[model samples]
Target: MPGGRLTHGDRRRIAAWLAEGLGYAEIGRRLGRPTSTISREVARNGTTGDYAADHAQRVSGDRARRRRPARPAEPPTAEQPTEVVRGFVDRFATLLAATGLPRMTSRVFVCLLTADAGGLTAADLVRRLRVSPASVSKSIGYLEAMEVVVRRPDPGGRRERYVVDDAAWLRAWQADTGAHARIAAAARRGVEIFGAGTTAGTRLGAMGEFFTWLSEQMSGSSLTASAVYDALTVLAALVHAGRPLTLGALAGALDWPEDRVTAALDAIRRQPAIADPLALRTVGPRTYTLTTRSDRLSQAQREALHR
Candidate 1:
């Protein structure tokens, strides 16, 4: 069973062993599989607290069905492109898929992301992806709806080309603004209907407060791209200083007005990466410092800050 596929019985045993608090190595020893195999299986299936043998088996079966069977190795050819760039594209595509994008959509997005042309037409995408025209069309439609891609008329009077520019993430944020407003409105209505002292009312009130704050931050007239970049500059300065700075000191260091400094800090606090991970911990009444280092950001934190 070391190199063989994991059976349903094997998965059940894994679940049982996990419930018994056995380590991956001990589980592997019992199952005649490698520890890495057991670890990957658990990670891909579910968390340790909620691992289900049946669900894991079904998911594994689906994944196996989706993947193409391995073929014998072949020698490299001069006409064939190097694997280096292709490998990176595949890895990035996988990362995107993990973030909830469908496989085809993730692959198409990554293809555009890696293209030197900066954009591509449907025909170009179909050729590059070796996917049907319908598949490419559907993938493009999904990306466009998510505001992750832009469609522009080609200069040569050809069909429209799909573009993924630097503003794609900005467009996505703008698209989510309406949803946040809707959620806030709905939650506030729930609070009014359920009565202020009720449990449901309290929960709704909290939700309303959070989403309303998010909506304000996202749609605030003063929170422009340039404003965000300035806020990031302030954050970087604090990190470099390696100590807490008062609000007055921050304004002085940036040579900006108190109002400007206040606005930037408000915007930064709404950002999850900066607010949750690299929080501006208060040293005194109006003094703050960066507690998280640059190298300590998690993957999600890095993406939130970068985007």
Candidate 2:
């Protein structure tokens, strides 16, 4: 069994084996390493699904470099500005790490998050974090996998820059729901294999339902731009009318395309954050109304709608 650290060749072989759908056990056997080592290596670099051999090699090199002795420190400059930036970075990165992000990954993300240019190159990251290039590379790999950062070609054709997009939070939200969807699917499989009447199956079935419900809730809340605008339009019309209106009446009041109004109503009904704030109600068959009761919604619901 080869020891020390995995060579670039080893990472390439691991990536190849992963692509062939081999489990950690089989891949470890072929590489003559323990399954746990293969598992941890893959997890650290990128999970099996997104692992890239070249990136893994670069990350490993970075880690090794970081463990070595550092050169003598240069004289400090701009003490106040540096201290302010350091304070902000530390506070923001600490908060992000508290939210389940790896510490180094959180620092890299916070660094990019706070950058005025909305992006940073590898060198920029290393300089800002005062860490080895490998650390930056590895952190970038994780952020890229999570879609927390994007890589763009540098204008000078030198190194690439990592960017945090305006929609990074939206993408992260969708990714989180996607994870729940996968959990639901896995639990459903358990239900099939264990029989619904069995205790194990019962637990699996409940777990599947919970994840599926959570996924739908997350998905339902993310209305498209058009949908949000239309929903607000319908809501405004209902507020103006100040009374329950049948679907036909609501359509006429808006003077909008029937399909547009219908779709908007559906969107509002599915999103409780919006619906609760508006005091939206279905009074009778195909009828809708907005309540005037100020107390209908809690403070939290109102805040959520604004967001």
Candidate 3:
């Protein structure tokens, strides 16, 4: 409430105003900002207990970063260089596929995510991805469905471009919960295929129930997975920020075992969340992280749900 920016400061005062018995119009009049702005600022940032100034500031900062330095590309490289660069797409596509996304789908999204502007219209995508407009359209539609990226109105012209935000992967993470639900349901159905009384069925059914229940707890319970992911993400960010952190440091902070921390890191690293485990180097005190195929159960769950 004390330190605030335009959209944010206006909110802090508005909350206090409401608590002190000031109406929206009264608060707007007092702040000299529009009533709608004040209303939205509070509505968006206000929590059950408090408005969370730190959270508000982080959101505002993220929004600001999105608006900064639009597409400052390296001096447009020689056009011919692209021929050489296009070959890299295969490598890029391979990396994407390894992360569980389709090859073309991975390439298309990665190209957009890493774009200097963090955005590209369909035409730009076609040119960059070296694919027909149809291919771009199809891949982009899937990416949009996955919430891997989002479309925004282009300031330059009529074309709407898919723009990657700072929270792009977080959106991707949010989408995973739904995918997990489908997986859990499918796993439950697998019990019948393997015979409910058999070991496989019993194991698969339990797997399905556990994943479904865990996902629900994380996503729909009082404490959301997104919140936990956010906190861990900050810790991950700090680690990647070049400050050396000991495994014990995080263990003390989260009150978790070193091996447990390592396992969790391995899980996330295997997932598309980390992209590179090297960034999470201290996962087990100098031991390299291992690749994991954690979705085997999730896939079983998805199949079970359909049954």
Whole-model Cα lDDT of every candidate shown, in order: 0.80, 0.83, 0.65
Q: Kindly list the per-residue Cα lDDT of model 2 for residues 25-132, writing each as its tens digit.
A: 999898889999899999999987999999999988888789985788765432212767888888988998999999999988888887756378898888778899
lDDT of 1: 0.80
lDDT (Cα, tens digit) per residue for candidate 1, span 164-268: 988888788887887998999999999999976789987887788678767756766435787777778888879889888988999998899888888778777
How do these models rank on lDDT, best leading?
A: 2, 1, 3
- How high is the lDDT of residue 204 in model 3? 86
Q: Please rank every candidate by TM-score, starting with the best.
A: 2, 1, 3
For model 2, give the 10-residue run with minimal summed lDDT.
Answer: 74-83
Query: Where does candidate 1 have its weakest 10-residue lDDT segment?
Result: 76-85
Task: Report how far off residue 80 is in candidate 1 (Å).
Answer: 7.7
Alpha-carbon lDDT of model 2: 0.83
TM-score-superior candidate, 2 or 3: 2
Model 1, residue 233: C-alpha shift (Å): 16
Steric collisions counted per model: 0, 1, 9
Q: Which stretches of candidate 2 lie over 4 Å from their true place?
A: 1-81, 224-307
What TM-score against the true fold does each predicted structure earn?
A: 0.45, 0.50, 0.42
Evaluated at residue 229, the lDDT of candidate 2 is: 86
